[model samples]
Each structure stands twice: as C-alpha cells, then as structure tokens.
Target: MALKINKTAVKEAKAGDKPQELRFEDGLILRVQPSGVRTYYVEVARGKRVRIGRVGTVTPAMAAEAAKRLSVKVMGEGVEAVMPVRAITLEKFIADVYEPFVEHEHRRGKRTAEDLRRSFADLLSTKLDRITSRELDAWVRGRREDGVKAATIAREANQLQGALRFAVERKHLKVSPFDTWKAPNVPQGNVERYLTTQEKAAIRKALSDRDRQQARERASANKWRRERRYPELPMVADHVMPMVLVLLNTGMRYGEVVKLEWQAVNLTTRTITVVGEKAKAGRGRIIQLNDEALKVLTTWRALTNRTTGLVFQCDGEPIKSIKTAWKTIKKMSGVENVRIHDLRHDFASSIVQRGGSVYVVQKLLGHGNVSQTMRYAHLADEQAAKAVALLDGHKRGGR
Candidate 1:
C-alpha cells in the first residue's frame, strides 16, 4: 500500500517474508526488509535510483528534504548530470584506463607504463578537471630542481600528454590539460658516440684476456670433473666475451642479444632473426653474420653443452644485464665516454666508413626509419670527399 512515509508510520510498518518499499511524495521511498531494517532511496527518474540514508539514522523529514532537492536537481539538470560529482581521480584513471590501454592497445612495454606511473605520482590523486597546465609546469619545474635532465623531463611530459589525451578520448576528461602546454624541448637527434678503431681493439684485447683466464679456469674445472672431485671448479665468465662480440658485430641492442634464442640463429643461412617480443620495433629483422661474428658464434656454440634456449646464458638462464662485466671491460680497455649502446653506433659507423650507403646501414642496423640512420651521415663525409676528388681527376675547366 502506498502511504505517506513518516517516522511514526515507518516504525509502525512491518515487512512480511519479502521486503517492502514505502513510497513518499517527490520520489522519496523507504525500503523495509523482512528483518525490520529500513533504508531510504530517491527515484529521480524512471530507472535512476539514488540512496539517501537509513530510516532511523536519517529522520523522515531530512530524507524527504534531500529527496525533494535531488528531484529538483534531476528536473533541472537531467539524470546524466551526476557524472562530474562521481568523476574518477587521476590515480584511478592511470591504473584502470591509461596502463591497460598502453600495455595492450598501444603494444608498448611494461617499463614504459611503469615509468609513466612513477613520473605522474605527484598528480595521481588530483581530479582530471582540476589538473591544470600550471600544475604541470610546477611539476616540470620541480623535476628540474631535483637534478633530472631536461631530456628525461621532456620524455615524461610527453608520456603525461599521451595519458591526458587518452583520458579525453575515453570521455573521462573533456579536454587535456596539456592541449596547449609546452613540454621541455629535447635535442632532435640521438647523441651519437662511436668507438674508434683503437678503442675497439683495446676492448677486444681486454675481453680476450678475460677469455684466456676463463679458458684456464674451464680446463681446471674439466680436470676436477674427470677426477670426480668434491666440488667442480666454479663456472667462470663465458657469456661476456661472446655477448660483447655479438653486440659489437651485429649492432643488436643489449636486450636483443641477451634475449636471443638458439632458434633465432641459422648458421647455414648466416642470419639471426630477431623476432616478436625480442625486437624493439615489435617486428622481426634479420642480422647478417660477418666473418668475425660467425667465428665467435661458432666457437661459443661448440663450447656450449646446451644447444637450446638463450644463446647467451648465465647459470643456465638468460642473463638480464652485463653491467658489471661491461664496467670492468670499459675500465680495463681505457675506452672513456663510450657506452654498451655505442657498440651499435660503432657498428653503424664501421659500415658507413667502409663506403656503405646510409640505406644499407639502416637495413643492417634494423632501424625503423631512415632518420635514425642519418645520425651516422657524418661518417660518410670522407667518402663524399673522395667521390668529389675523383671528379677532380676529370676536371678540365675548374680552378
């Protein structure tokens, strides 16, 4: 029975086995359960319900007043108007929306999403609409004051802009705070640093020295294994030399080389296919093995007992990093201001120095774009000069 629900009537009303709802004026309602618990709700529209409060905890007059106000709001603003009041926070948006979209939709790595999360920690709790460009500027300024490089800040800002755009696209936000915001400018081209021929030789000598030491250790270990000694000699460094050789030869990133499996290498074809997740570009590329690279791989493969899985392994597993080994090699080799990645640059530089076209270098290095190949264009200047010199031999009217 629909009766005007007041506090006295609410107390008097009893529910049967099923729960009962008492309707009041202006869409106010009191729901009574079989156990005699009562709760109030306001039916703003046909299918839209908004909970106000419980029967006793909130007096009937107060619920009625709230319901009346909400009814006015619904009449004036419509049912869909409550979204801003329930807008998701920045943290929720990042966790629920941005991260999933980046990892799955964008096909980006987990490291990228993690970096964005870390970079935006300061603004994680703020609402999307409340986040202003001024706030972003302050964040950039704070990052700069904290000794972070401008390039790094620029990357973080670009990530932030992407996230904001994502939010807008999903309708979680009406407009991006970064729509007109200016991110810090980073240098256009990559910082190219290639090892000189002498530097390369020094590094190779250092690696060879370590290799000799490792060989001696291996021989001793083999003797111990044959004699069935208590503990066979511990496994010495075997991966570093081969890994370094591959990096220097093929120009593969450290990640690509470390993750390389035996299946990727085809000795007959003289090619290594960097495929699937192993490639940075999300596509496969073939790396042709030079004589030196082929020799190193052949030797390493001959010595390796396990023919399957990662070509480079430490303790029968893929090696995550070569930082310590590389640091020691760099120190011993006396090659200053060169990184492991510079090996790839050196490889490209070597190709360009040998009169190889930039297009050839690009194909060899597996670069996605020619622009990435253009950084080593400076290496071709001598060849260009030589080409011009050839024209001088046929000159008849030039001064």
Candidate 2:
C-alpha cells in the first residue's frame, strides 16, 4: 500500500495559516511543504511525528513524486531516486549515487562494467543536462590517445548517453548533450579472435599440466592452500591455469567464472547455476557446461569438501578479483593484449565460427538484451566468407 498525496492541496497547506497535510500509504504526511523550499518531506514514527530532510524545494507536483519515491523505497521496491537532480558531474554524480545503484550489475556485467566504470569515472564533469555534442565529441576525442581504438571508445561513450537519457526522462537534466552530437567514425581494428582447434589443444595441454602437477604435489596441496593473512599464493598452478580453461569453455564473466560453487554446478548435467547478489542482475542464471569445462570441474571436485556449493574457491576462501594473478598468468602464456574477458568473446566467437546462430549465441551469453551478443556477429560474417571462398575455389578459377 502507498500513500497518495494531493500535491495541489499540499502546496496550499504551505501557503495558508492552516497547514494542508497529505498522508502517504506508510502513515506519513506530505506534511506542510512551502513553495521554493524543499521539494518533499515526510512525517516519521513515534508519538510526535518528525519531519525528514527535504528532497528539493522545487514545486508541489515535483515534491509529491519525491515523497512517493521515499515511500516506495521504504516498502522495499527499487525506487528510482533523484539523488542530485540539479548537481551534475561525472565524478560527483557517480560518487553520490550511481555506484550504489549499479553495484549489483558489477557482478554480472564483468569486463563490460569494469571498462565502462573506468571511462565514466574519468569524465568528472560535463553536466548531464547541458552536455553539448561538442563536449561529448571532445570527451572521446581526448580519450583517443596512444592508438586507442574508436569502437572501444564509442562503446564507453554510449554509457554516458544512456545516463543522460535516463536523467532527461527523470527531468533531472533538461537536454541530452548527445542530441546535437555527431558520432565520430569508429575504426574496426581486429576481427574477433577465437581459439582455433589447435589453440584449444594448447590450452588443454596447459590444463593437463596443472592436473599432473597436482598429482605429484599432493603433500603440497595443503601447503599451497595454507596462508598467513593472504600470503604469497602458489599463484600459477591450482587456480590460474585452470581458470583460463574454464573461461574458454563457458561464456562466463570473470566474476561468474571464479565464483562458481560446486553446489551450484551439477556434474551429472554439466551446468552451473548462478545466484543473486553474486550476479549482475539480482537474479539467478544457469550456464550449460561443455565437455572441457565439465572435465576441469570433475578434476576439481575430488580435491574439495562439499561443505559449500562453490566450485572454484581456493582453500576455504572464495576467489575474488583475479586481476593480479591473471596478469602473471598472461605473461606466462605469452598472449599479448588478450584479456580474461576476451575469453568470453572467444566463446561467443567460437560459437559463430562453428556455425552457431546469433540467437543461439545470445542465449549462451545470458545477456539481458541481445545487443551485447551482437558484438560477436563479425565472427558469423567470417563464417559466411569462408563458405563463399569454398564455392569460388570449387570453380576453375576464383569467381
């Protein structure tokens, strides 16, 4: 139940000797709100109802909506709040509000969130409402230093556009800066690089090496797992190498891949179930396991006590933030500029290369929307090219 406020009367209460009161569903009043001072106010609990802080001092209509939101929040709905409706800056806006709102997305969005967070964090300020196309153009233009690709820059820039659009919809910003802005020509650099069958063999070989080392060093499994307040990890053998194999097989976020619990993963069905609060969306997801991902899990399952469902934890602790160790693993693997997340792109890319449809790829990636899956469509095109190339080669001469 929600309290409905007759905002017009609430304003009248502020103006007259007899204060007008509008009660919210939660037993609070719109209370006595004055014009040009504090948008919204509510009465608190106890014998004497207390007034909470004012949301804004804008207008009665606006104030009413703000009151509605507080009510929604108290009732456990995800109410969209206008934290700093007038104050707009990349840094301050993000600091004051956006961080808490998108904390859940960080678990699911993975490298996408990681990359966008870095770009948005840098913009600092360029006002949400008044952002001119010139400012946005210059914003990305400045970021295109030392040969940063335009496509990557454009993807990050789109986030600002989305944020501004949201602000405008909520009337926080009067105009979207990008409305007048023209997009720069985005240059496509590398086509998607998925692992070849041979590349898979190589990664499999590395996984096998990890398996063999584990066999020879059973005495050290306890030694390697033990630590004194995050002591230097064995770092390479147990978690690092196998993790890449896991990523190669399942299109999971680094967070999702590492956060895998044995309890969530069904060895019989070869699928992993992802739960809320650990996922980008505050909902659970299930990813089907391929033979290779299943094999890695099988080897891993025996070494653990099934006290928890987590499949990929280290010792008794869960693996969080694999950045430092991954950097080392990358150097050891001799792969340049290849990220852990690129493994997902690699997974999606492999699906398309092997003739998987875009629709199928979308489901495998577990995207809330298909646009995220569209990034790998180029791999599908590459498949088409190979088909045409074969047809031409069958003729006497290339067509």
CA lDDT scores, all candidates in order: 0.79, 0.62
Model 2 over residues 1-399: C-alpha lDDT tens digits?
764555555545444454555566544455453453433444333443334445344455555555555656645732233233474765655555555555646663344445555565435655555557766666565454212457667777787776666567755676677777778885444535455666566555655665566556764654665643344434333666567778878877676766666678788987888776566565567888888788877776664545365666656666644555555544544555555666777888887888999888877777778887888788789889989888767685744
Off by over 4 Å in 1: 1-190, 215-230, 234-237, 390-399
Q: Which is the leading candidate under lDDT?
A: 1
Displacement of the residue 59 alpha carbon in candidate 2, Å: 61
RMSD of 2: 15.9
Superposed Cα deviation of residue 107, candidate 1 (Å): 8.7
lDDT of 2: 0.62
Residue 329 lDDT in candidate 2: 49
What's the true lDDT of residue 178 in model 1? 82
Q: Per the 3 Å backbone cut-off, how many clashing residue pairs does candidate 1 have? A: 0
